[model samples]
Target: MNISNNVSSITAHQTLLNTSANNIANVNTDGFIPKDTRITDNAGSVRTNTREADNNGSKRSQTDLAKEIPNEIIAQDATAVNVNVIKTQDEMLGTLLDIKT
Candidate 1:
């Protein structure tokens, strides 16, 4: 199994979810603007020799930073957790392989 794709997809999803959650959490905060998350499919079109791949794009939220800072921190924490999880999983798999050999 190609863990790279899975890891990346999971990370992307976590980012999207975190962004959305942050936006929603601050929906009632004054001057708070929600951020928009978008996934771009760059594979559909080829520009020269480059193959387009989907990239995570973030949009500015209408919510004010005062309200959004906390959520931003939470999002950053979540991203860190996700990265750690992926790394842990990869390491475990590697250990298993070594043990088998």
Candidate 2:
């Protein structure tokens, strides 16, 4: 398994979670435009980018709390899973080394 790729995926998810949190936090502020997370696949790895959203005059903050909250929760869960996988890999490597010794 490519640990580097897994780490990068976690980072990408983290960026998404942060962006969602920021959007939810500023949901009530006037003239606040929600930020969106964009993911691009670079070869086999992933890259995350955040951008400000365009707004219309009729909109308040351009944030939907209902959607943002669920997205943030999912990102957080995905990050946790990646972390667990890394931990499990490390344990397996350690076991192999122990056997070799």
- Please tell me which predicted candidate would have the highest TM-score against the true structure: 2
Model 2 Cα lDDT, one tens digit per residue, 1-101: 56887899899998998899889999898778888898778998989988877666645677878879988888988888989999999999999999999
Q: How close is candidate 2 to the true structure, as a TM-score?
A: 0.88
Q: Candidate 2 overall Cα lDDT vs. reference?
A: 0.86
Supply the global lDDT for candidate 1.
0.54
Task: Write the residue-wise lDDT of candidate 1 on 1-101 in tens digits.
Answer: 34564355445555655666666676566655456554343444211122222323434335445644664565467557657777888899999999999
lDDT of each prediction vs. the true structure? 0.54, 0.86
Off by over 4 Å in 1: 1-62
- TM-scores, in order shown? 0.43, 0.88
Clashes in candidate 2: how many? 0
Compute the lDDT of residue 36 as modeled in candidate 2.
81
RMSD of each: 10.2, 1.5
